[model samples]
Target: MRFLLIEDNRELALATRDRLTLDGHVVDHAADLATAQDYARTMSYDLVLLDIMLPDGDGRDFLAYLRDIRSDTPVIAVTARSEVSDKVGILDLGADDYISKPFDFAELEARCRAVLRRRAGTSSNTQRIGDVAFNRLGGTLTIENRIIELRNRELRLFELLADNPNVIFSKPKLVDRLFSFDEDVSENAIEVYVGRLRKHLAASNVSISTIRGLGYRLDIG
Candidate 1:
């Protein structure tokens, strides 16, 4: 998953970015409102970690601006404010989740996974597609009670496909989503990853099937 971190504290932002990167998420950092808004307007991020107090203005104002533009991207308010009203107000203003400052990095990561899962329409943290049990929070995949370790790209590809089972994604679309910006990607890259994922799922009920001239389908049934 790709994330945007909007924070003013340089040390905290760098530390958070490093932690999220280590957790297998691509993170972009912004020091203030202007930079954050600039990045948000141009790039497609899966989630945003926002600080309520910015150097320039209130984070709520930024949230309102995002909503005004109709950006439904999930935003998690990570600030020093832990008041019930503050949480309620942000939730009412379309924030996905809230975490107070001086928080545990592990807890923040967990909250991030939870919010992203909700956005992905996953009801539970552990999802079962066919016989495969995927722990999104734990970042592991299990088949028939056995654990299967997937490479980073493979895991990301599988996550995207499994998130929308039965939906046939075209090659170009798959390539765009799976690879990050600035990557030197090839048209065959998506196909190659799909092939590897198919073999990984061969023993289980899950499989990625070719859709003739269309693309590929991560079909469980």
Candidate 2:
């Protein structure tokens, strides 16, 4: 998944970004609310990790702005405020979840998965499509009981397609979701990933069908 991490603490931001990247997620770091707002305005993110205290302004205001824009992007407030009232207020301001400072990275990842699951309206992390089973938490794809090892970007693409199932994803949208702002990607990057996933699913009942000018859709027989 792609994420926008709004944090001012350099060390903490680096640590969190590294951890999420290691889990095959693309993360864009914003040290202030201004950059974060710019990114939010231009790009689509699967999730947003926001800090309440930013160098430029309060993160809660940014959260409110997102809500004001009617953006349903899930946000997890990563703040140092540990008080109960603080958490309640953050939630009331439209944060999907809150995590206090000095949190374990493992727990943070788990919370992210949980929030995404809730957003997807699924109670379980595992989603099955034909003979394919995708474990969102573990980031594993199994086909006919055998694990299909995919590269980071390929796995992310597969996850997006699997999560939506039968929905057509445009190349630009796929590129946005699969690659971060820092990566220099080509126009054919989405095609490359889609071709790779197609090969992996060739023998199964699942397939990726290109709709010519429309884009690609995952079809199940």
Candidate 3:
């Protein structure tokens, strides 16, 4: 998964980033609201771990702006404020979840995964497509009883494609879904990844089909 960590506390931000990176997630850090807004505008992230108390602006306002841009990107408020009203306000304003400050990094990671799963229309940690099965928590893919190892990005790519088999996704859309601000990638990069995934799926009779000008789609039927 890819994430943007918006926290003014330098120490917490570094620790959070390190933990997330070690867990196979690509993370981008922003020390203030200005940097966070700029990164949000220019790049895509799977989830945003936002600190409500920022130097320049309120994180709630940032959440509002993100919604204004018609971005349904999931956000989790990581703040010290634990009041019921505060949590209610952010959640009502479209924040997917909340994590109190001085919290466990493991819990944050778990929340991030949960939020993404909800957004992706997945009911739980495990997802299956035809004969292919994926365990989100385990980060393992299996086809017809055979285990298939995939990298973080590859796993995410498969999830996106398999979620709605036969639905085409454009290159830009795939890039947005699979990459974070830290990954310097292009549309062509998606093609390369798709090529590799196609080869891996060749033996299983799973196909990632290109729909000409439309995009790529996973054809299970």
Candidate 3 stretches greater than 4 Å from native: 163-192, 211-215
On the 0 to 100 scale, the lDDT of residue 201 in model 3 is 77
Off by over 4 Å in 2: none
- Model 1 C-alpha lDDT per residue in residues 194-220, reported as the tens digit of each score: 888887788897788888999888877
Error of 3 at 7 (Å): 1.0
Q: Give the Å shift of residue 51 in candidate 2.
A: 0.1
lDDT of each: 0.83, 0.89, 0.83
Q: Per-residue lDDT for 1-221 in model 2, tens only?
A: 89999999999999999999988899999999999999999998999999999889899999999999999999999989878999999999999998988999989999999998898788898887888887776667788778877788888888888778779999988878877877899869898888988988887899999998888898899
Write out the backbone clash pairs for model 2: none
Give a tens-digit lDDT track for model 3, residues 1-221.
Answer: 56888999888888988888766677888988889888898877778998999999899999999999999889999889879999999999999999997898789888888888898788788887656677878877777677878777777787778756668889988887676655789899889889878877776667899999999999874
Q: List the residue pairs that clash in candidate 3.
A: none
RMSD of each: 2.7, 1.4, 2.6
Candidate of highest lDDT: 2
